[model samples]
Target chain A: MSVLTQIKQAPAANPIERLLLATEADMAKVNALILSRADSHVEMVPELARYLIESGGKRLRPMLTVAAAQLFANGTGTAVNFAAAVEFMHNATLLHDDVVDESDMRRGKPAARMVWGNKASILVGDFLLGQAFMMMVETGNIGALGVLSSASAVMAEGEVFQLAKTGDLTTTAADYAEVIRAKTAVLFQAACEVGAMSGGADDAGRKALAQYGLELGNAFQLVDDVLDYGGQSGTLGKNVGDDLREGKMTLPVILALAEASSEDRETITAALGDAEATADQVAAVVAIMERHNTLARTMEQAQAHARSAKAALEALPGSEMRSLLSEVVEFSVVRAY
Target chain B: MSVLTQIKQAPAANPIERLLLATEADMAKVNALILSRADSHVEMVPELARYLIESGGKRLRPMLTVAAAQLFANGTGTAVNFAAAVEFMHNATLLHDDVVDESDMRRGKPAARMVWGNKASILVGDFLLGQAFMMMVETGNIGALGVLSSASAVMAEGEVFQLAKTGDLTTTAADYAEVIRAKTAVLFQAACEVGAMSGGADDAGRKALAQYGLELGNAFQLVDDVLDYGGQSGTLGKNVGDDLREGKMTLPVILALAEASSEDRETITAALGDAEATADQVAAVVAIMERHNTLARTMEQAQAHARSAKAALEALPGSEMRSLLSEVVEFSVVRAY
Candidate 1:
């Protein structure tokens, strides 16, 4: 099944049906806009740019943008533009982030940086960022532009914060949350909020959507952290222990190390410090997480965020879109891939 | 004398006057604003955040930003914000550029990456970028945001273009122009255009200012390139032949290499390829430039650009500011430091 198809089928069994339904209700439209928006920039090299745009990533962020707009604009069509804008923002960040991380592989494919070289990757990422703001300007939405630029600023700040915290085991959950919000969730939140602002949702509706995205983003990242530890490498489309190899201090590892005996903590810390940590050593670190149930404990926190995200949706008047949003919350908890 | 004091005292004696007046008229207010925009979020270490901002360096880009605004605005005060915005953009690039270059020095001080580590530098750069956009957004001027974002995209593109062309002697003046325009001139253009837009200049006026800035920026970079080779080391405040050591394919070297014998070209290219070109080899390369009159040839091109920049300014109504700008063109061509 296609990614969207799998999402559609799983909604009935999901606890957070509203989340998925809201996202699903907008997915077809959001995906269509994303696929077509490239037509807007014929001046750029399509051959080079298409690989990234057509890459079969889920359109969650864009959907949130559109969904937010829909909520605020009294169900207007501005959501389509919001969706495209958010995706551009996400893709821009992804392209640059790959370079910063020196990451070679992403979503089971060679990353843009690896395929195109850092020069191409960095420039293209920049092109997309400019294009994003251009779209926002075209929308003639001052509030939307404010939210996006602010969110982007937060996102970069958070990424830098994470960069600062790298390989440091003293990192706390609060610290992790601040970085995660900036790095991942702020865009997601902005995506939804911009969507709402476009839809002319009253201030209150905009706030609700913003809260929902923030919580959902937190849940999404927590699950991402869990998958880094225990998910099947093939299924996750990430190398086993890629996070450990990268020396990224994610919540599972941070929490696991914090709770470990001194000897085990020393081992984890030493592995983090060494640039050349072996796969066996990474596996050993994973074993420590399992022993501490850090992944499971983190999973529970993810569940709490999912619940908060779902509850935020309760403020929205019921619609097919609202139901889909609820499903997104459950999908956040149980998705294996 | 302190840099600021020296800048203030030399108001019309060529370089000092243009630099100091520009700093006073454009950067003073903007620098104050730029200094105040840091995030005070409990999680962010403000001390670390302020490292680059507090580090004393000439606010040249910000001055350019303000000058552009002043010319466009023509007695309006809106240029101050644009000035700050442009400087923010310049500093953001510097933060990233430092990391990419892996250099450990700036203005005879530890580079942001050197003092704070690459992660901090990178993150702070991201923060500055965010702050730049935020400042633009506050203008409530979509056009301003568009100009700033477009300039940003161009800057990154130029960086990549330069990166791709490095050490490739086959690169032409046209290719070099494209790289320099992207890397440097566009921001100068944007700085001017954004000022015009804020100052309510007609499209013609805005276009004129942008063209002037672009030409001036080209001249500015050419002079910088020349200074790297031609200026006294201490006065230039940069290591002599620093660009040569860095393998930067600046205009003088490119021009010189173009005229060199096959053996000379090979020797220069090989020296460039080595990560550590000796000081004696650098001096030998300089000797070749003196022999071939490449420095004079390069200066002629810079002078031509300075002339074109002056011609562009003729479109603007003559005023004290206009005369100051005219003086800057002459200053750019003649300044030894």
Candidate 2:
């Protein structure tokens, strides 16, 4: 049977095991390529890069690159290169975003900007972004370069959109989704879709994989917003109510604020919209979220996205890899970390 | 005659003319390709993007891309695309640099950061950089992509190197040159060489054009640094003494300090190194520069680079375009604005 036929058959019984074997298995090789493990500022940029990658965060994007390539051809090394490229782009965004937000912490550690000054952080981000394009060129895969460039453009647009909305309290769920998709899901989709392009997935297969990844990314972000609202509670590296404190209007808060009574809306807005919001005020906003059932509603929306993401994979030939991808949808909403 | 032969033999009074024509003629088409040129924040980003293209800052780098392509083969219209790509990259860096330096004016107007907040300035700079790569891919020129990507890596590395030396009084001319190459010259070299590549220039022609651009760029930035030390006397858009106030270690000061006696050196260091150097103190440091003839010395260096740049262009046969390129070497050291 063809490689495409092979990737499509038999969803795996154990999702995490497949995720580990398919994605994380090549970490050593990627580390060697980055030569970042031995860097002095490893704690600064390189560490942050690794933390974002290895902090048990899903490697779905890179896996998509791997799987996409596999659909057309098979090479352990080629797959690893594409995977690393996706991750490099992802980390670059995180670095810049932290500076843009004046964020002091990310994934529960002082952010790169906070630990290193903004200049170092910003320049390092640029360096990594440059390095990512270099890697794509090294691939000599024009198609892959196209995919990465498009994804990066979407990411930058998302960032600009987010900047446009900063401190504005009227952001809608649709607008929020637009931001998330531009900033987050576009890269995810591009990651998976590019895999197909690189791997030799036919148009139909590439389209399917891209759709699956985009939906999955949306689901992942939606749940991430939910968790920020006090859902799973004890995830290490998780900062509770950060979006609220930053006055960022995420999906849950937007929905909740719309549904809230005038008085509660006033209170929530008063607390969250202020950049100088106190912890007590932040806690009070969460209480209002509970009263308005915004958190529950957000979870419902998350589940719906998760279901759609899984459904995208259903038509693909069921392989252990596909099953693991399906399990990623569950993990998106289920895991605390 | 073939494109290479044509480039070699054509005699134009101004070397920059052909490049200027390529970019200037393409402006309408370039403007059309940009999204949301009339959006509310268009004044912020799209407007800046347009201002950048229209502002008539030396189109030297873009010209290099064009010249490089023409040297290699028939450029078709791909040279135009690569030209736009390099310009976008150059403009993005300029926007960000102004912000990082807290520079108040550029091209004779308030810098983008001064008009917009630092946050907006930075994000918009990022948007343009992303747009540049997008433009590159749209050109369907993978070689151009490789050239520009490597240039960006060098550009970023140069920025990091400069950041490392900021406020340090002991930086050498060699150290400064390394920074200038990374920060300013690589893109210039890439621009010319990429043009040659697009034009299907043979390897030797491509190499020659790259060297020409490198020397030309080095010449341009050296004069720029001299201008920072009152090289222009009065025609610059912004105040001349600002760099010293910001503790920026430019060439004039580097040379001046190197020759200062211990007492003068100590005074210069103490005055310039202060986070809040008084205007008088800044002026005092300028006086030290005058006493040491550092500015004149730096100007001599700039003139030497101009000669070198002109020499490099001689490798190409005499053409009107080549002559114009040579004129740019003179203009780099002599332009009033």
Candidate 3:
């Protein structure tokens, strides 16, 4: 075969792709459970739910869950339930978030709210959360349940904290760290920790995996914040600089605001959270961030978290799973696409 | 002392009042647990949560939990947690519902969403739900947790169903029954069932309390529907016919529409979802309902459920607590104020 044909026939080329390939059998189960649980007699529940679920993002969170479980134990049954529950929690957050942010786009399509309305989005989010908790309860894993339930509460608090901080130029780097940890990293931590629990990992292994997931989550969110300013529209699943228009206090903005000249700062603040902001207005702010090296600095911060995440996996013995997980973190920080 | 003074000093005079007085000590603990659990690091979470929690409706749901538990066991300790969790679930629903309904008032005051804006209300509701699950997880009662988590999901489905049926003139009495059972009765049933579980009741007792709660809840909602037309403005915590204006398919509306002539039906339909419907317009609908005996018939339906609720208590052994519970049911349907 020609080289192009050979490449096409190859198994998988990258960390996330390889992870998906490795977890295919297990993810099929998780996906089935997710779809079955999303079903309801109320037709709209399944209709709107499937619209979002089938839109099909990377399913990264569930993948981490399945991966962590496999890393420790060989295909434990509870992992399927936990993985499904994690995905549900993640999607539930996304549904509520679109309403809160009043965003028009999610996963590069009109948001479920746009189709169904904000009321459905909120109620459906509630429905998914109920499903998530029911899944956890069904597994009869109280330990894992506790970790996830606590994480869920923290995530809500994080969102509230982030919402409160929105459009406030006074938001600091420390506050930004808190926001990222609570809103994003906590769930990742819970996902891995629960997977470890289901896999019957020992205390040290569970702690290490939890740390790895937490750090990876931090890196993932940092990259996302940077992407909101730097990535393509379809790539970000939203317009460029959505964070600015939403008044999100992302690392790039915080860093730029701290470093820019008074005149340049004026430019940034004017566009920050201005929903009517022109493309030129956002481009101007991006230029300010680039001049201050804030975007790249934010990437560096992501890299640091990725390093810590990779370091966390060292607690486990060397294995293909460990290496793949490590590479996932590394790719998260480095990839622009 | 004057006779009136003695009457006031003796004790609570009504069945509901007696429930309040009897459950006072336990309700205090439930309230304390509720206040403490509602506390959070995010300022707005606690502030909004407190605004709702402290707005202090009768605290009826938690009272049912505490009462059920007390009837079966003196004090198992888990009941307090369950009671607080129940209250949280309730407040979370109210916050979300107000946002869904675009309600300006709740519990005779400005709705939390009106005070804090829809975003804060939604986030805080989520935060409270998380805390509720955390409380459940902490109790380690998987059975009660299952009951509640499932009820939470059902409640969401019921709300969605109600929202879908809003202003839908084709709504049937059966559909209304399903909506009430899912949205209102299920939580009440859960509260009592979990309370019974925490109190270490036998299956039969647990079931009896659950039935009683469900029936009582049905009666309670029916009464609420009537009160929207019959009760004073401040008493309803919303204006008269707010339900009509919102196009809620309450029993009276459904019953009247089924019997009304096309001309009268047109009048009701026009005012059904009209937020701008004036007092005179609402009164005209009420007059139509009275002409058809629909409001009184709704009260009869409520009375039937109340009888069923009282009958449920017969399965339990006779006791002061059991009689008190029965009286609460009877009072529910009979009360006009």
Q: Which stretches of candidate 1 lie over 4 Å from their true place?
A: A1-54, A71-81, A115-124, A273-275, B1-26, B39-49, B71-76
What value does the lDDT take at residue B87 in candidate 3? 90
Q: TM-scores for chain A, candidates in order?
A: 0.88, 0.86, 0.96
- Alpha-carbon TM-score of each model against the true structure: 0.88, 0.89, 0.96
lDDT for model 1, please.
0.73
The candidate that achieves the highest lDDT relative to the unseen native structure: 3
lDDT per model vs. reference? 0.73, 0.70, 0.89
DockQ of 3: 0.80
Q: Comparing 1 and 2 by DockQ, which wins?
A: 2
Candidate 1 is graded, for docking, as: acceptable
**How large an RMSD does model 3 have?**
3.6
Q: State the lDDT of candidate 2 residue by residue for B187-230, as single tens digits.
A: 88888888887777777777878887788778777777767656
State the lDDT of candidate 1 residue by residue for A172-196, as single tens digits: 8889978787788788788888788
Order candidates by lDDT, high to low: 3, 1, 2
Judge candidate 2 at residue A99 and give its lDDT: 75
Per-residue lDDT of candidate 3, residues A117-180 (tens digit): 9999999999999999999999998889999999999999999999999999999999999999
Candidate No. with top DockQ: 3
